[model samples]
Target: MSRLGVLRAVCVAVGLLPALAHAFLVNQWETIDTSTKRAQAAQDVQPGRAWIEPLTGMDMVWVEGRCFKLGSPPKMEGRDGDEGPVREVCLSGYWLARTEMTQGQWRRVMRNNPSKNRKGDDYPVEQVAWDDVEMYLGRLNSFYTGRVRFRLPTEAEWEFACRNGGQQVRYATGNSAEQGSWFQRNSGGVSQKVATQRANRLGLFDMSGNVWEWTQDAYDSHAYKQIEPQNPLRLGAHPFRVIRGGAFDSKPAALRCSNRGFEHFSLQAANIGLRLAAEVEKPVKPRPINLRDTLL
Candidate 1:
């Protein structure tokens, strides 16, 4: 589902979108008056490289790392109480799946499909718990001994990529949820196939709606302050883990880029799925209990 051309176009469009190439701090999402502005935001998202993993035929896109404020302003629509006490987050470049991990990919490795619906191979695999996802990654890693290791994205990284390199946007497809997402308004109470809708500026699909994506961090309403701002990952044996993006039955407000959701670590639901993320050319290392402690 990766749009190779969009990644290639980033190189051609970089000069045209100089403002985007450099990070500018915007305090708020600001009001979007017309679709023209939204259209321009989508066009200006000069993304990085993209490639496909041959083993599972998974399309991977490179998310170029940059720093930006990590939560929503207090007055923003759909603002959650936990989104406040915003902090800046700087990340390192990493590979992210162009779409949610599909049932086909899950079955190809695990030898069984765990999704409740089991619609087909192309559908996003749901009913996966956090530990189940970790097991899948473990099985996936045994096949490839290369330096690149597969895992769930950290919430910061997920939001950074979802916001199109940390831009002050509301959704992956821009402020409008209608353009490239399947939500309560039009989903008819069902999740659609991955990439059935348009991709975001970074050539990623289903980041706003379709299914809730599990992340590496534990859920903490005060996570922004609990973790370090750089490559933030809130690690703990917490009861709940962070989940990103909304589901097919989710309201548009729930799909906001900064929206926060959490579920018991073992909870599995029809609307929850997982996306793959990876760090390349290095052996996987453990994240710190407190990211700030590692720096000291």
Candidate 2:
């Protein structure tokens, strides 16, 4: 080949490198955005990965481990009396369903849908008591062949996710509840379909409003004082369990990220429901067998 022709080929190849590099970065960027892992970018995805819940086909997001200040600060707008005395909490990474359990998912597991809004299968299942949620989780776990563990998020986990991994936002998405939620003023007095509103930074939906989600924590006015640095699950003989987010009947103030609510464990309401949290089981390694012992 002529020297000029070879030089031209090298130049053309060099010119294409930038475009190729840009495409590669864009691909990884999108993967990071969509992936349900602790990965904030392509570089963060490790050997372990997250998965969709088989029974419900729900998309889950990994909440990365970190320390964050929980509860509303004094004098913050819409602060509840119980939202005070801010606490620092650190949690280990875990998986959380991106949306509330829909009516269709509930029916598939429980053999009956208890949602008051029979208009559509996508609406969050409501009228479920905390006790009912426990039964659903039991059946769901049994269906998985012990591959994963599932339960309600703790109050800290709920608040952390709602704040988009512990940002100090008033609502899940931002300060404006209307932008990220369906509340009394805009709900038309009915539960809307899940994910109809904006999702938080983690791509979780219905985190500000839709239906109040039951947490695993037992309700207590003074629990924040006892928060531990690790994953804190406040369980005791309390009569009421924590309920979070807000409901279709709730006002904007009630939809604030730190707003705390509770319900009797046995009580069910049309606007009360749950979101599921999951933890993948680590693979077990078998010990080496001894041939000498086997001969005996």
Q: TM-score of each candidate?
A: 0.78, 0.78
Task: Give per-residue CA lDDT, model 1, range 128-203, as digits (tens).
Answer: 9999998989877655545467899999999999999899899998989998899999888877889999899999
Q: Model-by-model lDDT, in order? A: 0.83, 0.83
lDDT tens readout by residue for model 2, 177-208 = 87889999999998899998889998899998
